[model samples]
Target: MATGADRTAFGPMVIVAADQHEARPLIDDPWARRLLPASGRLAAALTKYRPIRRALIAPTEKKIPGLWASMLCRKRYVDDALRAALDEGGIEAVVILGAGFDTRACRLPALAKIPVYEVDLPANIDRKRTALTKALGRVPANLTQVPVDFNTENLADALARHGYLPGRTFFVWEAVTQYLTEDGVRRTFDFLATAAAGSRLVFTFVRKDFLDGTRLYGAEAAYTEFVRKRPLWRFGLAPDRVEAFLAEYGWHEREQAGPEEFTARYLRPAGRDLPVSEIERSVLAEFTG
Candidate 1:
């Protein structure tokens, strides 16, 4: 059976679809059209495949019926916030760590002129490239995929080969932290500290309460599914502890928000129907180094 990175790889495809669903829709596209039989289009492309649809997605949603919708809305909220943060900092370079078929580099027009480096497990990178190539007939010029195993590789060395400049780069580290060991998470922060000043990070972390049974909307379902998943949640910080924690790593907190805050901020004001139980919180911080 596929365990570890192999199993974890499929998680992002779902995230990508949720992303397309919650974010701006295409000019005239159905949900299935948004997702299927194409790459570089939207997350919907992955959904088009029968094997993946049945194997990876079916079981997860079955475990928690509305969880898929919530995940999508969660992406909607976080991505919107990350875009604003990066834009404000001037996205000279974009590096998506643990990038799992995320199409942000192509989806956001402002990034067209900017170079994008997507770092992920090699297996997933190969899969993404193949799918995207099939979808677009070729990979987009602005996007560069740097395949690396975050557990063993030096992010700096890998990015350096791709012409990554540490200065003022915008980083997206969403939905990645909890899967990493504490050491692994620190290694990433260590790399960020090495980047040019004004470098910013946008990331999500599991909240402490969720693990303690103190929070979790569909508590039983959420906990059960997480346990069932191959890459289990290994780390989370108390909501109040994030700023101080990042400060120790030379990251100055710019924004910290819970799911409720994001829903009200990103969804409700826009008249979106997606509802997210404010479980995980996203934080935006800048590198002091």
Candidate 2:
């Protein structure tokens, strides 16, 4: 989240997303794979010399897996599934907020014909653009990068500047809300609330209990250690209160799934068991008014 020292954690998150750790990856992002640092590419490439990915990365990843990377895999599973369903159900545009190194616009074939707007801070956009151009020569035509600092610019204003339509849409706000202030979170929800009817929003949040000292998931110590020097999680809504929270913004909650739910609904069905069970949770909401 900072400019330099510890930096945006997107790089490591992308490394795990691009890794073929699972037999069938929840998300496939070549841009992530291609943009990796030399050492990361070497390690990631070494894993998949076709089949060695599972064997080599397994042992080392167990020692220190990427924080929230597995959770992202689960979140992406539900989010992408919801996206595909909504795409067929008639959403016209896809907007990805805080989309750092996310490759859904390029990777999901269903989105081939849909316009994708990716919003992020200018510096992060520069890094993403540089790596993308270096790896693939040019960014994709269907994808538009909108650079804005969330603290200063409104999400609605940024998208409107780039010709975003207030029509049927699917908004993906992955792993971003926890980084914002409570007021910022409300501002975003307010925007989503007014999106054309039938538009849906998919976003992730940390459990409020995690912040208030009720860690049920057994991974707390390691998670605590991980965030010691990093940007701390800023805001959260209790899982049980998400419905009431959404109601305040004129949206109706459709589904809220945690790692356990994701495991049962996605990973188990795929017969894929991640090294560490993820802890983050996601809520899917639909505009009601």
Candidate 3:
């Protein structure tokens, strides 16, 4: 319910919070509840009850359809990918690009022993620090907060100044690409291209048609709010082009997943059949060089 860049940070935390209330949640993020604003915390608390969940949460999920599932599914997907990469053994560090209120550094045990750098806007970084402090008493020692404005700053330089080294790293860019322009996305990719071979990248992107209003994917309300009204989203990529796009940047696409893939892989297993928004998709790519 925030505005501007900060809105992205808040919205996902709320979704995480709501997801936590599920009986068999695909993701576990109790810290999400603690890190929310008062209003968000109230919503999280109210939805804990069965009646409120059916009356309030169910209606919203119905209206938005796959919106909630999409967010949760992508989160689970990234988490699984990160864990598998860690298991394969070669990643030197983890960098969370455009990290908002993401608690992965604190929540995931796999990251507990490795160096983790969280890069984001200064304002979001500050808020994240405060929220983490309040929610967990202290920020985890393994995690370093690196503040950078992607529009005007050099990501590589920022990471270097923060002690990030050139090595095989796992980068998680979640729910952030749509807010950046094409040049911005390329700039980040240019930096990623410099990473050592075998480095992994997991990110989420919206469909190009959705951004240009050529397609709505049955979520007109989301388009009206995020596209036309506020005009916060700035870029999108077609699913078919994802492979070539990653190849152009020296990244080899490993997997590209959307609603159907998510429902089959994550939702149905938990005895849930929630629809996921078709407007978005996630990809796992590895540095080829």
Candidate number with greatest lDDT: 3
Error of 2 at 214 (Å): 2.7
The segments of candidate 3 whose C-alpha lies over 4 angstroms from its true place after superposition are 1-3, 55-64
Cα lDDT listed for each candidate: 0.68, 0.69, 0.87
* TM-scores for every predicted model: 0.79, 0.84, 0.95
Q: What is the per-residue lDDT of model 1 for residues 191-230, given as tens digits with 9 covering 90 to 100? A: 8888777887888888778766676656567676564444
Model 1 clash count equals 3
Q: Which ranges in model 2 have alpha carbons more than 4 Å from their true place?
A: 1-6, 9-18, 49-69, 222-231, 275-278
Task: Return model 3's CA RMSD, one decimal.
Answer: 2.0
Query: What's the CA error at residue 88 for candidate 1, in Å?
Result: 3.6
Summarize candidate 2's per-residue lDDT along 1-289 as a digit string, tens digits: 3533224535454445445555766555555667655665677666665456555545435533433345545556555656665656888888888887776776677787888898887877887788778877888888889987665568898889998988888888877776777887888887888788888888888666665556635555534643444445667778889999989988888988775666676566777665444346787788888
Model 2: per-residue Cα lDDT at residue 199: 82
